[model samples]
Target chain A: MSSADFGALKHPFVLRALEPSDYRKGYLKLLEQLTKVGEISEEEFTARVEETRHLGDLHHAVVIEDVERLAIVASATLLVELKFIRKCGKAGHIEDVVVDSTVRGQHLGQRIVDHLTELAKQLGCYKVILDCTEANVPFYEKCGFGLKERQMARYFS
Target chain B: MSSADFGALKHPFVLRALEPSDYRKGYLKLLEQLTKVGEISEEEFTARVEETRHLGDLHHAVVIEDVERLAIVASATLLVELKFIRKCGKAGHIEDVVVDSTVRGQHLGQRIVDHLTELAKQLGCYKVILDCTEANVPFYEKCGFGLKERQMARYFS
Candidate 1:
């Protein structure tokens, strides 16, 4: 959905696509709460944003911005993979979902996930999946997702 | 790895990118071994292949073709997602991994997955992940992936 499509997002909060200007809005800073996000310059962030923009609907780096504070309070990305199964169906992989620590109780995580789920449905996705820790399963279950399988990973050194 | 970079495969078998002509090689039929594949016309398959082709390294749909049988015996896709984490790093999501039932015992699944893992590393991904059934846990563990988390999903009707 477009920024306009999200309607009024609790007054000062607006959900929208990651903009070039979000570099100054603590976008990367917010991500540090999730994982190891090292030093990222504005040029690097802008280049990546342009690359994602070129991908159109296939790459959505969505964010909830606090207009009053001029900071990114929550973020998530939905990467749609078109498949040969289910007659060329699409699958959505929700990644890097995080809500800033200070804004935890407002249900922004659910809101962002719900919005992206809607977007995935609109994009003709047959299923939307995500990998989360056991502690986060209850949160995701509350957001309409069910525990399906185990996630396996290999982290580079 | 490129088709050339994959070194040599077993006799009459070659690993490479999905081709436009693979529609005739039963690509969708091979995918059927994994999940439901509805009636997919050649036009639709070609369209999707072209779209994936345009994405270059971001979408790696590697396949193992049996020249003698003139069929695709195995298939998997590695989708590299550029992330804001790990200093603007990339992560690989391996999906729809399936080996033709007829070709299961030859270690084709491991070969395909290991190749993709190497490609992910070459692409500078900080990690590679996949969701699998409990029954398949040992297989992915054999491929050097450790059980990381639970996978959650929402399937659209």
Candidate 2:
């Protein structure tokens, strides 16, 4: 019922579907951290937080909260896209899995992934894929994600 | 100078900044791909695309298009977040570098990344980070990404 209730569970952590209202809090947390460290101009940070809340709504975004802490410790989303490989197939691309640094070592990360993987399967994804930095390869591999042979790009100007 | 002009280059790939006007086209592309292949329901796909496009805008999305094809070959964004190390730094989290499958193996993918990397540098990002499956390790490495550490996570439901 409460954010702390969610985090205090004994088993690894439980996942929850994020509601529209959660965005403001999550964005503010991110903004607070950014501002405390002076990584963004206050103007830029405010604008980004507002914009990100809108985007989070669009992604069917979900969060893994530390129920005890009443904080969103980790989050991930399935970016479902259609593909015509040989024949049409549904693809689920997982993106944006962020875990709070304070809770990094408690196996909470693996729990969050397990939850997302199940969601992907239920969605009937022919393939559930995610990208991670080189450092994170072993973790995903441990989660059962194999290497995909594709080049990725982004156009930011 | 114009979206049409961007659509006119020989090989004519144009990398444009994401705007509110472009959200519809971007969302449509994501929905059509995911829905046609059955990754998500029409309703879910539409909703998710809208959220992602909005997020993309907040992060300063960019798109690469093949003018003649009138198709988005690739897209990516830079999420400006603060790092929490002793020497906290501003970092760029690169997200969703997707290139249409039909155009895979062309250097378009690399070009898109190059553009964004430059942008990250200009934006004063100490480092630009992205994630990919093990399969993409070599490709990203070839593009100059060094191995960091493995990231792991679990989903709780």
lDDT of each model, Cα atoms only? 0.90, 0.54
C-alpha lDDT of residue B140 in model 1: 96
- Candidate 1 residue pairs in clash (backbone atoms < 3 Å): none
Task: Please give me the DockQ of candidate 2 compared with the native complex.
Answer: 0.12
Residue A76 CA error for candidate 1 (Å)? 0.7
Report per-candidate TM-score of chain A alone: 0.96, 0.68
- Residue by residue across A5-110, what tens digits does model 1's lDDT show? 5755796889998998999999989998998899989999999999888888898999999999999999999998978888889999999999999999999999
Q: Residue A12: error of model 2 in Å?
A: 20
DockQ of 1: 0.91
- Per-candidate TM-scores read 0.96, 0.47
Q: Which segments of candidate 2 are over 4 A away from where they belong?
A: A1-157, B1-11, B19-58, B153-157
Best by DockQ: 1
**Each prediction's RMSD to truth:** 1.5, 8.5
Candidate that scores best on TM-score:
1
Q: Candidate 2's chain A scores what TM-score?
A: 0.68
